[model samples]
Target chain A: MPKDSALPSRNGAASPGKEPRTARGRETLRRLLDAAAAEFGERGFHEASISGITRRAGTALGSFYTYFDSKDSIFSALVTHMSQSVAAAAAAAVAPGSTGVRREREALAGFLAFARQHKELYRIIDEAEFADPDAYRAHYMGTAKRIAARFDESVAAGTMSPGDNEVRAWAAMGMNVFLGLRFGVWGEEREPDDVAAEAERLLRDGLGPRG
Target chain B: MPKDSALPSRNGAASPGKEPRTARGRETLRRLLDAAAAEFGERGFHEASISGITRRAGTALGSFYTYFDSKDSIFSALVTHMSQSVAAAAAAAVAPGSTGVRREREALAGFLAFARQHKELYRIIDEAEFADPDAYRAHYMGTAKRIAARFDESVAAGTMSPGDNEVRAWAAMGMNVFLGLRFGVWGEEREPDDVAAEAERLLRDGLGPRG
Candidate 1:
C-alpha cells in the first residue's frame, strides 16, 4: 500500500482549512498528532485539552487550529493515523514472497513489537470505541479486510486451504489482537517471535496432533 | 464444576453492607442489576445515574442501597455477574460428554446466542476496561484460565495435540470474541451454528488445505 493510502480518507470539503499545503505544514501536523497521542493517551479524551496537546507539541495554539478544527476531529484523525501505522508495521515485517502462515506469523510478530513499544496504542484505540465509534469500527473492519486479502493471495499461491477466508481473516486478526494484549501490553516476558511461532502453529495445523 | 464455584469469589470483609441476606433482597438485587444493564448500556457509565437505575428497576432509593453502596460498586458487580452469565451460558451449551474442539465449538455457539440476546453485553464489558480496570482484566484473565483448563482436560483425554495450551487457549478465546463482535453484535446475517462450525473447522484443522 502507498504511504498515504494506508491512512483513513479525510473530507477536504468538510473542513476546508484543515489540509496541509507545505512541507512545514505537514511537519506541524505530525507534531500535533504525536502530542495529541500523548495528551489523549495520558489524560483521556474528556480531560485532554487542545492547549495540552499544543504545549506537548511545543506549537502555538494557532498551529493546532491550522490543522484540526476541534479536539474531536484531531482524535478521529489520530485514530486513523494509528490504524495506518499498525498496517505499515505489519507490511514492513513481511518480506517479499513470504507465503501463507509464514506471512501471518510475521505480521503478528510485527504487531506485537509495535504494541510493546507503543503501549498507548491500546488505550487510544480502545477509547475510540466510545469516543469515536466509527473510527473504532473502521479500524478493525479495515484490518480484517487486509488480512482477508492476504488469504486470497495465499490461496492463489496454493499456500493455504481455500475456506471461508473472510471468517478466517477475522479469526486471525482477533488472535493477533488478544495475543498482543496479553503478551505485548500486559507483559513482555514472552518474546514476540516465540508468540508468533506458536500462533503460526495453530494457524497451520490447529489443535490436532500432526502425523 | 459446582454452580457457585464457577463465579469469582467476592471479599465479604471488604464491604459489609453490600451483601443481601434474604430472598426478597436477592430479588431486589437481580432487579437492580437488570436495571443497571439498561441504564449503563444506554447512557454509559458517566452519564448513567442511580435514580435512572432505580426508576428502571421500579425500586425505591432505599432498595437500591440495600445491595450496592454506589454506582461504581454496582458496575463492578454487574461486570462480574455478566462474566458469570457468559460462563454459565457456555456451560449449559456443552453436552455431558463433549470433548476437545467440540466442547469449544458448543461454548462459542452458546456465547454467540447469549451475545445476540444481550446486546448490551459488549458495551458494558468493553466500558469496564476504562470504568473498572481491575474487573476488566479479571474478566478476560479468568476466562482465559477456564479455557486453558479445558485444554488440559482435552490433552489428558487424548482429544487434542499438546503444545503450549496457555497460548492456544488465549488465541482461541480471541477468535471467539472477535467472531462474536462481528457476527453477533455488528450483524446477524450469519447463523450462530454456521459461525461455530466454521470456527470448529479452523480449530480442529487449520488454514492449510486438507489432503
Candidate 2:
C-alpha cells in the first residue's frame, strides 16, 4: 500500500495511528494560533475580536471555539507555543560542556534569531505582558526559570561569579527582555547579530567570574 | 495696587508688559493635562474618550476644548509636559562632575521614583510609546541627545573612555524603555529601590569603558 493511501492510514491500527484526524486538527490549530497572534498583536489582547481571527484564518467562527474557549485561552496557547520553542532552542545555547561566555553568546544569538523570526509573537507576548500582569508573570517566571538554570550552571562551573543566583537570574532575564524590546518589540532597525554581540559583551564583563 | 492682582506688579519693561495672563489659565492647563494623562493612562491613548477626561476634571466638555483643540492637541501638550519634567531630572542626574556610574544610577532612580509617585503619568508615557511610535521616537531621541552629551563631556574631561557615543546613547535609551515597561508600565510588585539598583548595576557593567 502507498504511504499516501488514506484508507490504510485511517485503519492503520498496527501503529494505532490517527493520521488524518491529527493532521487536520493540528493544521486547524496552527492556523488559529497564527491568526490569533496577528490579530491580538495588531488590535491588542482585549480589543481583538474572535470573529476577526476566524476571518483572518479563513476558518469557520465555530472552529475557533473548537480550538480556543476564549481569546485569553488562545493567548495562553501562544505562550505555551513560545515557551516550548524557546526551551528547545535554549538547550543549544547552553549545552552541558559550553563555557559561560560561549553559552552567553549562543543564548543571546539564539534569542535574537528566534525573536527576529517571530517578531509578531514577541509583540503578542509583550502586549500580553502589559495588558495583564499576573497572567504574563506566570509566562515570564516559567521562561525565566529555564534561563536561570543556565545561569546556575555557569556559577557551578566557576565560569560566572557567585552572586545571588536569583538576582543574577532576574538581571539575565532583563537583559534578554530588553534586547527583544530594543530590536524586535520597539521596531528599532538594528541587526540581530549586533545586538547579540553587544549583549554577549555585556554579560562577559558583568557576570563572568569575579576575580 | 494689589499683589494678588492677575498682573502682579512685575519688573515692568520700559514698554508696557505683554498682555497680562491670569493664573487661571495656567491652572486650567494643569488640570486638563493631568486629567488627560490619567484618562489616557488608564483607558489607553486610543480608547480614552475626551468626555471622560473632562468629567474627571470637573469641567464641562466645552471647557476641555477651550483648554485644548482636540485629543491630539491634549496629547501633544501632555507629551511636552512629561518630556520636560523627566528630562530635566535626568539631565541633573548626569550633570558634569558626576561619576559616570553614579550619574546613571541616579537617573534610573529618579525615573522609577517619579513613576512610583505618578503611576498614571508614567503609564500614559508608556502606553503612548507603544501606540504612537513616531512620538515615542521623537521623545526617546530627544533624551538620547542629552545622554550622548553627558557621555561626550565625560570623554572630553578624560573621565570616561570614548566609544560609540551614539550607540551607547541608544543603549542608555533602551535600558530606560525596558525597565519602564517591566517595572513601571507592568507594575511588578518589586520595590522601586530594588529595580533601580538592579538596572544601575546592569548599566554600569554594560556601558563602562571598553578594556
Q: What is the lDDT of residue B188 in candidate 2?
A: 58
lDDT of 1 by residue, B103-139 (tens): 9999999999999999899899999988999999999
* Per-model chain A TM: 0.92, 0.77
What would the C-alpha RMSD of candidate 2 be, to one decimal place? 8.2
Off by over 4 Å in 2: A1-23, A42-47, A83-96, A99-101, A129-131, A164-171, A185-190, A206-211, B1-22, B94-96, B165-167, B177-201, B205-211
- Using all chains and alpha carbons, the TM-scores for the candidates as numbered come to 0.94, 0.75
Candidate no. 1 TM-score = 0.94
The C-alpha stretches of model 1 lying farther than 4 A from their native spots are A1-16, B1-15
Per-residue lDDT tens digits for candidate 1, residues A3-100, read: 45333333221135577765577678888888988999888888899999999999999988888889998998889888988999999999888989
Q: Measured against the native two-chain assembly using Cα atoms, what DockQ does each of the candidate structures obtain, in the order listed?
A: 0.74, 0.13
Tens digit of per-residue lDDT, candidate 2, span A1-211: 4444443312231112322246576577778777877888777766788898999999998777766667776776666566656656666655667766568667767776677677776657656545655646776677667656766777677776544445445556666765665575565587776776666665555422233
C-alpha RMSD values across all candidates: 3.0, 8.2
- Say which candidate scores most in DockQ: 1
